[model samples]
Target chain A: MSSTQQTEVGYVVSSRDFLVYLDGLPTIKVNDMVESDTGLRGWVTSTFEDKIEVLMLDEGAIKPKQEFRRLTNRLGINVGDFLLGRAVNSLGVPIDGKGLLSRTKTNLNLELDREALGIESREFIANQFLTGITLIDTLIPLGRGQRELVLGDAHSGKTGFLIDIVVNQKNTGVICVLASIGKPAVVVRNLIDTLRLNKALDYNVIIATSSSEPPPLIFLTPKTAFTIAEYFQKKGKDVLLILDDLGSHAKIYREISLLSNKSPGRESYPGDMFYQHAHLLERAGNFLPEYGGGSITALPVIELSLSDFTTLIPTNLMSMTDGHLLFKAGLRSQGQTPAIDLSLSVSRVGRQTQDQMTNLLSTRVRQVLSAAADLETISRFSLELPPETQLILKRRELIMEILKQDPLTAIPKQIQAILLALPFTTFLQNKNRSFVEKYKVIISEAFLKHPQLIPITKSITKLKTDEELIKLLEAAGAVLAKLCP
Target chain B: MNEILSIILKDTYSLTSLKHRLRILQSYFLKTFFGEIETSVNMPLSPQDSNWLKSLPSSFYQKFNKDNIYNIFSGLEKIGTNTPILTMHLAFELNDTTLSQIGAFTRKTFDSPSLLLDIKVDPNLIAGTALSWKGVYRDYSLRAKLEQKRQELLEEFRKFLR
Candidate 1:
């Protein structure tokens, strides 16, 4: 290691937009870094005969015949717990105006596109990943290492919902990494401010690229975020990764692909679009104890066109993920703040981590909601219905009312279980939607902090059946009844 | 090789010069065959092109018919693709005689007359030359030699500073 280390050099032959083709550096592989004479940086994208293509990572010009030095570093970014509470770009440069990150021994240089662990190194997901959302916890349960797609149309409260999830992970020991790809500057600023205000930034890392950045830099956002997440996950820490939206990521890739002469496939996307995304996402999973025993729960977001999930990108994401949660602008307009369209959403691996009582309750809740939907269609004729049908309809109303939680609120799992079973208790018999809306916060606070109820809440897992839990809740309602009376 | 191909190699001593000749040939074909033509360089042939044509004997023109025109182009293209380029950086620009002298020496040394030279004017070289061949760069310039003795130079400069 002499001070004057001999490095391979390349010369730019042709350039178009952000893509530059070099006629030399015969040994340069894809994703290796190269620095121009003007000090701009680029990542080698592909290698052709006697030439290689590069995507510029910085905001600068690389002219034809300009010289470049091939760096030994492959595609990588710096990582550490010091990255917590800071915002950085794809190159690991701090963008939050927070100067440099504090020096820590945990700092590491991790590859941005490291290969994922194979099935032999992966363990089955055994623990539940909680977002503190009552409806999701009770119905579409998620496992600690599952990759779930969060999808909806624009303005569907998707970002707000994602922020709620991050905020709710406040003290849960789950490290959060949010990759905000090609979002507006204000959105990133507001997100940082919100996280800081909630004190959630202490445990969160944000990798952001604005829409105005170079396409190549924006294209690296999600991969950099995943790299940071992998760092924490390998340290035996649970990580929650949120890719704000991959729709913009796909478009950037398409632009890069079409410019580099890749033939377009369906929807004008490159043929390897699926492989590119799947490769990035496959890095997330639960590792076996022999492989460090940690889990990475990824929520990759995609915005649909006019709520059409049948589009190519959305369907591709759906097929790759364990399940999807479809938010709806229609519901958001109806005042369902952070509106999650329930019927369309599915969770493939979440049910496995749920307790038996929760599994039973979820089945009953689904049955009632399904029957109510079918009966409501028939009841539109103003025909008389049986007493059981009326009770089912009333129960559906109560369930929907209880599930309408405010933004930034994270209800505990025991409280969610107690709240969902309350409709079965005698306490909520005469309660209307307005009544539940007015008292839901007070009820949740009481259940969380009440001296007599904490034991029952703690013992929720011990209760074997949904009826047994409902019975315990009915008894707990006695204390609430005295207070609310 | 055909005499026409051998003729194209004469005075084409650099990649830049070869590219210029290729562009001129393309423009010529565009004007002669296509109804319209557009190139980075304008359609009109310059003195250099005329000089190149004059250097060729009349037998070359008799050989340049439409049927074998592609044979000539494909042959030129093959030479362009295969010829290795050597880049040199010097402190000052060279005169045509100096360039031709340097070109002759390099052509004789490398044993390939068709090899191309890509020269760059770099004032920082300071009275010597830096060369890059096939991406391997070696700086034999006076500046590099001085930089190698930078520590001793700095120690001498410190005496003046004090």
Candidate 2:
């Protein structure tokens, strides 16, 4: 219970009177504003038979909780105020060394304990959440109020992709809740450090159940995280909930089953595992419609062996998601970050939920990439192909030259559109030398008008001395400009 | 001869064959009492008198000069008491008159009861025949029980075989 009880030291955030009791010590008055001899005032919030929960709003807060575990001296207990951009444990003690967390007890309750207030958007998906990462923004674009499962083998960049998405959320103004269940303490430490270093922790709320904690407590970690997200959503803020990996959470269910005397199924997993995974993921959908307008976007990660999609965990999530972005292990070995095999990865909601502009850009780029793939496949079949086959191969080589991009870097939408619509189709089709000479000016003029097409234009500009590639770019640019316009 | 017997059993199948065999064997034994054996319309012994003959072993009764066909065979046939059902696994062996009596009893009970009979030969039973009915396996073999008793005592049956 919380009350507006002000003390001489600082403000108290409770409604009911609490007796501060440090076990085996004399009890202090519930309303007393006690202070340490060290000049740090302690504002007590609640007291239990074993421990006292106090908030020290002063500059010099109490020592870390772990250090005081053995001490019997209870000289006015105090913990510093909780602040954003710092890693704190469940008891709201700072774990990351980024100093005490700044806290203001809100009139509203922090833990939203209510069962889902019946999602206002029964089954509606719109208003995409943009993660400024290029490969995702361009290809499998994420939508608000949808659950996407990123499934892959271990060491395939699942956590890396999640971190990238969380970091990129700064641009979209979305609040993030990263819930790590059954993860190592070191992982939580590194994540907190990374978030703080990037200043992304200012918008992030972390809830962790480390491997050393009891299994039952670890099981409730993700649910506690969603409750926090729901609190943000009620205040009309968009929230992103990322379950670092749910496979271990399912292992907790299997442990519960074994403890409860149930027979294990394949791979020692419980028989009712489908329901466990399905219910958890189904909770991640949009709760409030655009009319009332608040959103929760979920990205649940599934780990498999050697990127095998047939594993029970991966298969169950694959069927539940709006789409999946697979990170291939082979690509990761090749020093590729976000090692997505683009040809195999796809978004089901590609054109379905996108604006007309993004769809037009993505479709043209996809077609050019597909064409390049086909030509590359055929050139291997015939060793001694004709001159026309050679010409097709050359055009394909030019397409790859234009499409190659670094995944971590993002290209803006307007630029993405211009690159797809380069007027090189006509020049690549040019046969007569007179037509090549005449249309070369037409292609250059088109590229000069759209700065977005500068990358490909610069490449073709370099190939001006090489007549063949110049002709290819002019032909390709003509075809794309007409199609895109 | 085996083929002829199979064909005859296949065609003229009836309970009368057992009765006919009983009469023929009874006539041979009747020569011990009468000077010559005679095929008679009626049996010399009553049903009550045949009951004692039924208890006698086939080895002891078969050596008698008096007619002993149907008496000994029908005697051992009275061993099994339960009715046969549609699906069952039963085995038969003619060790002494007990085996013949069992065969006759099973034939009468299971003829119209949809039962299957399997015959096996094992001389090592050493005494009374063994019967396995339905799922229950019974061992009336003296040799088997002797082997078990010896095994329980942790002794080999090597001396008992000679």
Candidate 3:
């Protein structure tokens, strides 16, 4: 239909905070845009027989009996490559100090909410998505286009770990988009500053909304972030989209739903709460070349309460995503920077993307770690153990120490495999915990430099078994011991 | 319709007319409930209120107690808010005769005798009407016609100027 025939107008009959009930605009559908006389914008959320509910995008001087014009289009935001390295709000307006987004570079306004393409439009997720953290890279890997939930309690290093991933994407050709939804203003600034300090800002896009904005506006931040990521993905560039805490997004939706008088179900959230999150998350996937070919690897963060993963939002997210990586506050306090609980974490798609050698090696590492955990509990009750059991307990402690990496350091896939395999080799028997801590980087650097170890790095691709890879490192014992000493 | 509502229903087809007649009815009821009709020495009703009382059915005398007066005012106020209105924009302000004629035409054509008129004066309409109902607005004004043939009119004006 022509814009003229679709034209409708409404007068505000009643208003409460950011929500206004209009008496006309009978033809306005949900997600349509509306604006008041003074140019305040809103999204049409619910339509009744004679009234429509609009959640205002901005807090303005709106009063009863005010006329609002129906905008011609559904709700959408302008997007472009000019958005990279800049921070923007839910409206696609630049919030960074740099400048405005160049309108010429942007495509026509793209609606934020979109359903995932059908199965025919998608390909298998077969490439590993590295996050520089050795613990996750080896134990709980994630794949391109995978939707992995990064969940943790307060001070569990979730934010720090996410920043490390963005920083590590520096030269990898992967575009990073971080959505800081409903965070404090200072926290958003801190995130941007960390990216800038690492010189990672130029390749990343930050879509942020502070808690003080209107609830509906704050709630649109993740959707806006996804839209910006898709803009880059359309050109077949890989995108790592991080939603830094969807927990706040759920709360904001609950607030809007309750105020709109929708019936609140479990946790007083609206009945469609699961659908709201599931639909947004379903947009991420490895797509076939017919549909952009590139992938959107989404790491949606959720802050848990007291490390309880059984809560409504966390469990709902678990069932929706490919898998989750659980971060813990206790581990953070004990000097584990990323603080991920590998035993609790699972990756359904990442293992498929791993090389045959790395796959076998990680399985070996996990089996050993699991056995050590069981024996440690029993060793505390008894006084002594067999010679092999004692060695196994000692090896587990050394493996844990090697995995406890500092923030902002990214380990390569080969180096991560080599590092995890160190505890199993006899080379680690002589090296003390303090010795390994000081020279681990030196040992890792030797993989590229040392004469004997350099060929092992190339030979890793041909090695079929974890035992062969471990024996190869053990044979280069003189070089490893010299580097550590 | 209640006899009290019917007293002004025929004349009260517009929102402005409905409010004006309801205000008069409210005063007539208030004055009579205070014993103005029986004692004749109570507060005096204005000419409009007195005319309203004269138009009321004689049985209204039996229902003009305190409770009925409240119910009658509440029901009229409810109608004032709930009534569907058709807005008319005209080149000139409406007079009583033109408003009643438009109201009668609309009531018969739309089959809603209780429908209300919300009149707006827009001189730019240039001697024709623009109407809005149920949020849909359309221009049937002379201004709209002139704009529709704007290029032809401009050519004629240019010829005259040359």
Best by lDDT: 1
Which pairs of residues collide in model 3?
A: none
Candidate 3, B1-162: lDDT as tens digits: 255565577776677778877776677567656654764434366665566557667875676678767876887687667777887778998877788899999988878867888887889888788777888767787887787778899999999999
Error of 3 at A473 (Å): 1.2
Error of 3 at A452 (Å): 4.0
Q: How high is each candidate's interface RMSD, in Å?
A: 2.5, 41.2, 2.7
Report the lDDT tens digits of candidate 1 across residue range A1-485: 22242456789989999999987786788889999978999999888998899899887777778998888778898788789999998889999998978666455788887788899989899899999998888899999999999999889988888999999998889999999999998999999999999999999999999999999999999999998998888889899999988999999999999999999999999999999889888988899877778899999999988899998889899988999999999998888866889999999999999999998988888898999999997777767878788778888888898888889888889888888888777788777777777788888888778898788888997988999988888888888876665
Per-model TM against the reference: 0.88, 0.51, 0.90
Over A1-485, each residue of candidate 3 has an lDDT whose tens digit, in order, gives 22343347788899988999998777778899998878999998888986889999988989877878888878888887778889999888888777868847536789977666788988899999988888888888889999999999998988888888899998999999999999999999988898989999999999999999999999999999888888788889899999988999999999999999999999998999999899888889898887888899999999999899998999999999999999999988888767988899999999999888889888888887998988988899878698888888888777888898888898887788888888888899856677778888998889978878889888877888888989988898877777665
Clashing pairs in 1: none
DockQ of each: 0.30, 0.00, 0.40
lDDT of 3 at A222: 90
Per-candidate Cα lDDT values, in order, are 0.85, 0.55, 0.85
Distance from true location, Cα of A27 in model 2, Å: 32
Q: After TM-score superposition, what is the CA distance of residue B79 in candidate 3 from its true location, in Å?
A: 3.2
Evaluation by lDDT, superior candidate among 2 and 3: 3
TM-score of chain B of each: 0.76, 0.29, 0.83
- Score candidate 2 by TM-score against the native: 0.51
